[model samples]
Target chain A: MSVKYIPVQWNNNKWKYNAVMLASVFAYLWIFIFVTPDLMSNEGRINGAVHNARAFGSCAFLMLSVILCIGPLARLDNRFLPLLYNRRHFGVMTAFVAITHASYIINWYFAFSPSNKYEALLFSNTSYGQLSGFPFEVFGIFALFCLVILAATSHDFWLKFLTPRIWKRIHYLIYAAYISVVAHVGLGILQDQQNHTFTVIFILAAIVVATLHVMAALHEKKHGDPLAAESGDWVKVCETTDMQEGYAKIAQLTAKERVAIFLHEGKLSAISNACAHQNGPLGEGKIIRCLVTCPWHGFQYDVTNGSSPAPFTEKVPTYNLKVEGNTILVDRHANEPGTYVEPVPLNIQGAAA
Target chain B: MDQAQAIFFAFQIWCSIGALIALFFLTIGIDRIDEDAQGAYVFRLLLIPAILLIWPLVLWRWFILETERDAWPNRHRPPRHAHFWVAIALAVFIPVIILVSLSVRQTWPVDFEPQKLSLLEERKS
Candidate 1:
C-alpha cells in the first residue's frame, strides 16, 4: 500500500504471529534434541551435531511445506486470510532454520576432510552419474540460496521498489526452491536412511501440500464468473430485490474482471469487486453503515463513491447506475477510482414507471 | 598431479569465472524492482560475494531472469480439476517409488572415526 521506505509496521496480530512462531520453533528443537533420542534409541543412528543438523533440516522442510500450503488455503477460504497477513515471517524463519542445518553440516561431517570442507563437498562427490550417490547437495544449495533471496526481499519496501508484479515473479522462485528441497530430501536422505519416521512424514507433507493446492484451485473454478452482460452501453443487473440489503451481487465484466453492486439503505451503488489490498473479493464482504468492509483484513470503502472514508487514502473504481423501470441498468464504463458517483435511489425505478 | 586432478582444478577455474560474471552482471532489472537505486545496488553488491563464495551453483542461479506466474487468475493452470488429477496421479505414483526403492541395496559411506577418537578422551571435571 505504501511506496515510501517506512520501518516494519507492527500490530497485535503480527506480534502474536511472531511470538507463536518463536515458541513453536524452540519447542520443536527442544523435543527433537531431548525427547526424540530416548524414544527412537533402537532405530536412532546419528548423534551430536550431525543429528542436530538433520533435525533442523527436517524442521525447515516441514515449515516450508506449511508455508506453501497457506497461500492456496487462504484462496480457498477468506477466514484463512488472517494467516496470510504475516506469512513472510514464516518464510524468513524457514530460511534461518535451513541455514542452521547447513551450518551444522559444515561444522560436523565435513570438518576433517582431506581437502577444505567445501572443496571436498563439491569435488569429492563426483559420482554425479550414479543416482543413489549423486550430489543431491547441489539441489539443497540451490534451494537454500533461493530462500535467502526470498527472505531478503520479503519487505514491503522491496515490494514497493520492485513493483508487485516483478516482486511476485521473483518470489515464484519459492516453487522452484520447494521442488529442489523435495529432490534434496527424496534423493539424499530418504534413499539411504533407515529411519522410516522421516520417510513417512516427508511423504505425508508432500501429499498434503499437493492436495491442498489442487483443492483450493478447484474451489476458485467452481465459483467462477457468471455469464457476460448484454452488449449495449448500459447492462441490466438483476431486479432490485436480488441484491439483499447490505449484500452485493457480483456482475461479470467484458474481461474476466467483476464489479460488486451493493444494495444499501434503499439505494444501489457499484464498485470494483477486487479489494485494493491483495485483490480479495469485496463482493463476498458485507456493507457496514454505508462502507463496504472487505472480508479480508477489514479494509473499507464508501459504497456511494468507492472511496476510502476520511484519513485512509486507498480507493476503488465505481460504476454508474440508473434505474429504468423495474430493472437497474449500470454503465459498463467504470468511473475513475475514488471518483464519486451519486447512487441510484430505489424510487427512481418506481417514478420512471 | 594425475590427469583427474588437473581436470578437477580446471572445472573449479570455470566455476570461479562463471561466479564472477554472475555477480557483476546481476542485471539492469534489479534497479527496476526497487525504487531506491543506491540501496538495490548495495544489497546486490553484498549478495555478490555470497553469490560467489557460497557455492558455484549460484553462479548460474543468480543470473536467472525467467519468472513463473503462480498468482491469481494465472494461479490455476488447466483449472483446479487438472491440478487435482495431477495430485491423484502423484498419490498413485508414490507407492511404486517406495516399492522400487526397497529393492536397491544401500551401501552407506559411514565414517565413525570422530566418535571413535572421542571415546578415550579424558572427562572434564
Candidate 2:
C-alpha cells in the first residue's frame, strides 16, 4: 500500500484460505494413498512409494490446472473473485505438493543409481538426442523450479520490492510452468500408460485455458468503454448526468491512455484511469470521500489531485477538465503525476450518496 | 570430481558470469525496454539464483523481449507473447521428445547408470 515495503497484512480471510487449502491437500493425499491404489490394483502390482509419488504428481498437476483455470474464470465473472484473492496460496500449496512428488521419485528411482539421485536426475539420461527414453524428469524439474520461484516470491513483500510490473512478468512464469507440467504428464506417463483418461483431462485443461483467455479478450473488446468525442483541443468525455456521485466515467485521451472522470461531493475531478499500483483500471473504482479506491486491490489516490493521502505516498497523472454546456471537455495534455486541480462543483441540487 | 561433475560446475560458472552481465544490463536499462519494465524496481539481486539455474533463457528476456529496441522493418522485436509461445511449445514438444526417446531406446546405453539399465532390462523382457 505504501512506497516503503511492508509485510503482508494477513487477515482472517487469509488465515481461513490457508486452513482450507491445508485440509484439501491432506485430504487429497489421503485418498491418493489409501483409496486410489485399491481402485487401480487390477492394473498390476503397485509399488507403494512410487504409487504415492505418481499420486502426488497427478495431484499437484491437477491442482495447478485448477489454479490456472481460476484466473480466467474470475475475470469472466466476479463470482470467482473470491478464488482469485487467495491464488498465491493455491500456488504455494501446489509447489509443496510438487516437491513431494519429485522427492518421492528421486528417493525411489534415482537413489539406486550409481551417482547421487540429484545428479542422476539430470545426467543419468544422456538421451538428450533420443526421444523414447528422453529424461522427462527434467521437465518436471523445470516446472518445479518455476513453481519454486513463484511460490517463494508470492508474498506482497516481493510484490513491493519487485514492483507490480516486474512481479507480474515473473509470475507469468506460471503459464510456462503449466506448459512444462502438461508436457511432464504427457511424455512421462501418457506415453507409457494404456489408460487414456488423464491424457483427455490434460488436453481439455489446455483447451479450457486457451479458450478462456481468448474469450475474455473478446469480452473485454466487446464491453469496453465507448470512444470519446473529440473537440478542438479537448476530448469530450460525457455529460454530468452520465456520472453518479462517488463514481467515475472513463475516456481515452488522444495519443495517451485512459482517464477516469470522477464526480464526488457534487464536484468533478479527472485523473489517469490507471492506478499506480499494478496499473489497475481506476475508472471501475468508486470514491470514498476524496480517495478513489482501485477495484483490483484497494490502492487509493485522491481524486482531486491524483495523490495518495499522507504517510503512504503514491501519485497518478491528472488531467485538466471543464464543462462546455453539458458535455465535459478534458485537456489532451495530461498533467504530471500528483499535479492538483480544483474540483469544479456541479450545479445539480441532489447528489447520490 | 569426475568428468561430468567438472562439466556441470564449469557450465554453472559460465552461466553465472553470463547472468551477472545480463543483470547489469537489466539494472542499468537498455534501448529495448519491455513496456512492463515501468513498474519494476531493481530485482536482479533477487533473481541471482534463478539466473544461475537458467541463465540462457533469462538472458534472452533481457537481450530481446525485456529490452526495448527500435522495431526495425522486417526485423524481430522483443515479442510481447514470449511466455505464450513457450507455453504452446511445451504442450507439443514434450510428446515429440518422448516419441523420439522411445524410438531410439536401443541405440544408446545410459552410461554409468546400472540401476536404470536394470529397469530397462525389466521393460525389455
Candidate 3:
C-alpha cells in the first residue's frame, strides 16, 4: 500500500502551477489597477477597501474550492494528484492575498483616517470597531494567521520537525479557518447593501459546506457504534448462529449500543454499523471480499483486525465474540489484537415454516 | 512630454518594469519549453531581459535617486553593487506597481454589464 501524504507533494509541476497562478493573479491585478479610481477621497478609500476585501474573500473561496476538489479529483484520476499535491502553495498564496486585502481595509478605515472626525469617533474608543466595525475582518485575520502557520510548516523540514500526528492536529485548524471565513463573509460583506450578489453567493457556499458536514454527522449517528458514545468500547451484541447465513443480526450490547456480527463464508465478522469516513452505516454498505466498504468515501476496513488496508486509513475497535453451540453468545468486554477468529456455521432454525 | 503624458510614459515605464519582473520570476518558476531538457536555454533566455531591465533601475537607484544609502543598507560596496541592487529594487518595486496598476485601471476589458434576460432582448433594435 502506497503511503500517500495528506495534502500530498509535487515535484516539477509545482513550479508550473505556481507560475500559472501568479500570472493569472497579476494579470487580474493589472486589469483592476488600470481601471479603479485612486484612494484619495474618503469615498474612494472606502470603495477601495471594499473592492480589496471582496477580492480577498473571493480568492479565499477559490482556495477552498481547490482544497475541496483535490480529494475527488485524485480519486477520479491519479494524474490529477500533481495539481492536488501542490494545493498547500495555492492555499498559502490565497491567504496572503486575503491578508493584504484585509490589511488595506484596516489601514484605510482606522490607521489612515485618524484625523477625520468620523474615523476618530467610530474607530478610536468604541468596541464596535473591534467587534462589528470590521465584522469579517477579524475572522479573516485569524484565518490568514492560521494559513501562514500552515504554509510555513508545510515543508518537509517542518514535517520532520513537527511529528505527523501533531502536524495533522494543527492542520485541522483549516476547518476552523473555513468556519471563520464563512462567518466573515456572512457578517462583514452581507451586512452592506452594496454587495448583494456576492453576499448571496457566499451564503450559498456556506450552506453547501454546512450541508456536507451535517450529512457526515447524520451518517455517523446511524451506523457508528450506537454504544461507544453511551459506553466505553464497542460491544458485540450477538453471535453468528443467531443471524441468517448471509446477513448479520443487529443487536445492542453493554458497550457497543448497536452492532452487526455477520457470518459469511463460514467466518464471523464484527463491525460497528457506522462508516469511518462519513459515518455511513456499515450495515447499509455491502461486505465485499471480507472487507466492509463505506458507502460514502468507499473506505474499506478488514473485519478481522478492523483496520483499513491502506496507510493513512484509521480503524474502529471490535469486541470479543464466542459461539455457545446452537445459541450464539458474545463477550462484549474482552478484546484481543490480531487474533483471527471465524464466525460459526448457521442452520436455518426459524424460517423453515 | 507634458506632465500627464510624461506621467503616462512614466507609468508605462513602470508598467514595463512590473511586466519585466513578473516575466522574469514567471519564466524561472514555470516550465515554458521543458524543465528537464532545456535548462540552459531557460537561463540564457532570462539574461537579456535581466540586463536591459536592471541597467536603468541601477542608474536611477544610484545616480538619479541618491537613495542608495537608504535603499541598499545591506550593501557595503555602494557603486559596485548596482547590479544586485537593481534586481532587488525591481523585486520590491514590481508588486507595488502591479497593485497600483490594478486600482488605476477603471474599466475591465471583459464586459461586466448585467446580461439581458433573453437573446431577443440583447438583439433588440
Best by DockQ: 1
Q: Model 2 Cα displacement at B96 (Å)?
A: 11
Considering only chain B, report the TM-score of each candidate against the true chain B.
0.34, 0.37, 0.24
lDDT of candidate 2 over B1-125, digit per residue (tens) = 26557766786788778677656754664323433334555533444554465456445645554444422211111122343454355446545544543444342264654356788889999
List lDDT for all candidates, in order: 0.68, 0.69, 0.49
Residue range with the least summed lDDT across 10 consecutive positions in model 1 chain A: A157-166
Which candidate, 2 or 3, has the higher TM-score?
2
lDDT of 1 by residue, B1-125 (tens): 24446655775786587576644555654444334443444345444443343334332333342242223322111121233444454445444444444444375468734344455564531
lDDT of 3 by residue, A247-269 (tens): 55555553223455766666666
What TM-score does prediction 2 earn? 0.72
lDDT of 3 at A43: 35
lDDT per residue as tens, model 1, A187-265: 7777767657777888788778767866776676686546445758888766665657778888676444577888787
Deviation in Å, model 1, residue A180 alpha carbon: 2.5
Where does candidate 2 stray beyond 4 Å? A3-7, A38-44, A128-132, A194-197, A225-233, A236-241, A252-256, A346-353, B1-7, B10-125
Worst 10 residues of 3 chain A by lDDT: A156-165
lDDT of 3 by residue, B1-125 (tens): 14334544564586587566545533552223223213333333323332233334323332422332332111111121122332343334333433333333333246576555797677884
Candidate 2 residue-wise lDDT, A1-353, digit = tens: 55433234577988998899889888977886786664323265558877888778888988887887776676578677678766787898899899998999989887986785576667776776756666677789889989988876765544433445566777888877876776677567765554555556666666666666555655556665666888677888888778788889887663236778999888899988877666566888778878988776677899988888987666887889998677788986778778899998775653344
Summed over model 2, clashes come to 13
Kindly report the interface RMSD of candidate 1, rounded to 1 decimal.
7.1
